[model samples]
Target: MTDHGPTREELPFPDYDHLPITGLAHRIRSLDLAQLRVVIEYEEAHARRVPALQVLQTRASELEAGAEPSGGDPSALAPELSPAPSAGSSVSPATAPGPDIPPTESDEAKPPMRG
Candidate 1:
């Protein structure tokens, strides 16, 4: 059998910043043993501040001990800010997908001949 390795979903890294403290905490109260090691390493290298590091450590302990940490809904943390795309006149030709070339040439397609 061919090995595809692990998919992105299988990976432990969280996607959005909002997820680290909220969504991810609910999903996995504590990091897995292996993942804890990674978190410690990342925390040491980047965020050495006490409060953030303490939070990670606390979550790590909870995971090791099997307990849930309290946090807000991941969805509730961030408002859905994207505006809907405007209709018709606002649409760009580049974004409109098709085979590109016109199926048939019209009278306007011909250029005037020069003397």
Candidate 2:
């Protein structure tokens, strides 16, 4: 609740306001107690979203219980925001249909395109 550390703008996760509850939960795991406090205070003053507050509080409790913060760059891009792989999708020949598979055909009874 105190303003002892970073403000909302200075939060460990720069995109905190846009993060979903699940993402917030994951990101906060790497924050220490002080950083969590900043998030909690900001949330209380702005959104006051109960779920987000709960997640922050839970992590604070874990830190209070002597759990060390997880290792990661707090300012790193969020997983959802990371650039897609340059190699493209995971789909491969094994996952695609084989050439032998017949393409679907319209019902013969159906009228042909008027255009």
Candidate 3:
């Protein structure tokens, strides 16, 4: 929790903590070994999530094996965070049921009260 290094806001993936595990896999493809290391350290200091660590370690391995950093934009909006077309809520007045009405006190059809 102490000042380990670059703050979460200063890391390659500034929104790392908020990002989903699946999204993280794609986003990390753009980070170089050094940037990825910083993120790994930050993750260990904070959440230390196993899945995230796995993804990061896998990328590090790839980098060590001569795999180049992906050409995708690291600063691009995460697919998970992007607004999906026609993804709004389906609820509307047309789908809602009509309001219920209470019975009047003078109604003759009222049933007798239970004991």
The candidate scoring highest on lDDT is: 3
Please identify model 3 stretches exceeding 4 Å from their true place.
1-3, 82-115
lDDT of each residue in 1-115, candidate 2, tens digit only: 3444346666777778778787887788888898888888888878889999988998899899999999997777887565545977879988997688544565555777796
Error of 3 at 96 (Å): 11
Q: Which ten residues in a row have the lowest lDDT in candidate 3?
A: 1-10
Clashes of each: 1, 0, 0
Give Cα-based local distance difference scores for all models: 0.50, 0.79, 0.83
TM-scores of the models, in the order given:
0.36, 0.63, 0.67
Which regions of candidate 1 are displaced past 4 Å? 1-11, 14-24, 27-30, 66-115
Tens-digit lDDT track of model 3 for 1-115: 2577557776886567778898898998988999888888888888889999999999999999999998887767876885546968789999998998776777657777899
lDDT of 1 at 63: 67
Task: lDDT winner between 2 and 3, please give it.
Answer: 3
lDDT string, candidate 1, 1-115, tens digits: 1144333343345443233443344433434656544555554564455655676677777666876544433234233334357776856877777875754567568786799
Superposed on all Cα atoms, the candidates' RMSDs to the truth, in angstroms, are 13.4, 9.5, 7.9
| Candidate number with the higher TM-score (2 or 3) | 3
Following a full C-alpha superposition, what root-mean-square deviation does model 3 have from the true structure? 7.9
